[model samples]
Target: IPHLLELMGFRSSAYLSHMRTLKTLEQIGAAASCRVGREDILYQFDVLREYVPVVLPLMLANVLCPSVLPEEVATAREHVLEVQQNIGENTESLLCELLHITAYRGNTL
Candidate 1:
């Protein structure tokens, strides 16, 4: 369990120390760090991915439809297109290393 926690980046003294320094810097206005949680970040990306299907329709509608969307909305849609293109161009895959529940059960680093 301790090993797993370290692998996941908690129970690691070095990481905790770094986080402490970062927090201090943020407090003194020297640096800014994210306050959002993992779930929040994941949810935002999930929402963005959900818009993939409508991207083409939205772009086509921009040409055919008579109504003009607000500038901010147009800019946001362009942002989505850029994000989608970025994702599509990427070719990296995450490493697969399953953590074990018992002591020293999985592959060691």
Candidate 2:
């Protein structure tokens, strides 16, 4: 039982890491206006956005409830928020570039 639990824990950790990487790439692509060749990246981003907040709180519940661990939660939350902010800023820049590209394309046509 203990060994099984350990294996499950490792699997969960690996899954989380993979999810985070995919999410980061999506944010970068959205921000940079660089098209992602893989559809899976976008799908993963959608899933992560839906579940990350809930999963995060559950994952840290033991450390957060009754008494808050401000430092750990704050750090994690900040990192997430920073990623979101970066994506927003990047998205705006990408939109501007896209507009310019569209205008140029229209002019050429």
Candidate 3:
């Protein structure tokens, strides 16, 4: 179960890394990131209107056809674990997580 959670968290990083290396976002002067909510995952970007034509297809490709290479996965896994550890050590973060659990009742938030 923990492994699955880690994979879910890491996969977005892996995908983003793949896209960045391929110059999909940077070449078009766009910035992109992923967010995972309780019920949904979002892949979002900001780019100039003129650059949209160049970035949109690349973004779609990254989303529709992800290539989570082993190296990216390894790096993302390490990053996710480090972040999780940092959050664990932060009292405010722990309280926020507890608040979510209590307020959401383990349902989607």
- Per-residue accuracy of model 1 over 1-109 as CA lDDT, tens digit each: 2222122221113223334533533444442222233123111111244444533333233224423225434554666566546654454411111222243475342
RMSD of every prediction = 20.9, 16.8, 4.6
lDDT of each: 0.33, 0.39, 0.62
lDDT of 2 by residue, 1-109 (tens): 2222222221113134424533654654422111222121111222345556544433343223322235534554666566646765687766875887677774642
The reply for model 1, stretches above 4 Å from the true place, is: 1-38, 41-69, 93-109
Candidate 2's TM-score reads 0.21
lDDT of 3 by residue, 1-109 (tens): 2332334432333236553534756576677666665666776778899887776766676667666567756776787777778887899978987997799895654
Model 3: CA > 4 A from native: 1-22, 99-109
The superposed Cα distance between candidate 1 and the true structure at residue 28, in angstroms, equals 14
CA lDDT, candidate 2, residue 41: 15
TM-score of each: 0.23, 0.21, 0.68
Cα-based lDDT at residue 48, candidate 3 = 90
Question: How many pairs of residues collide in model 2?
Answer: 0
Cand. 3 Cα-lDDT: 0.62
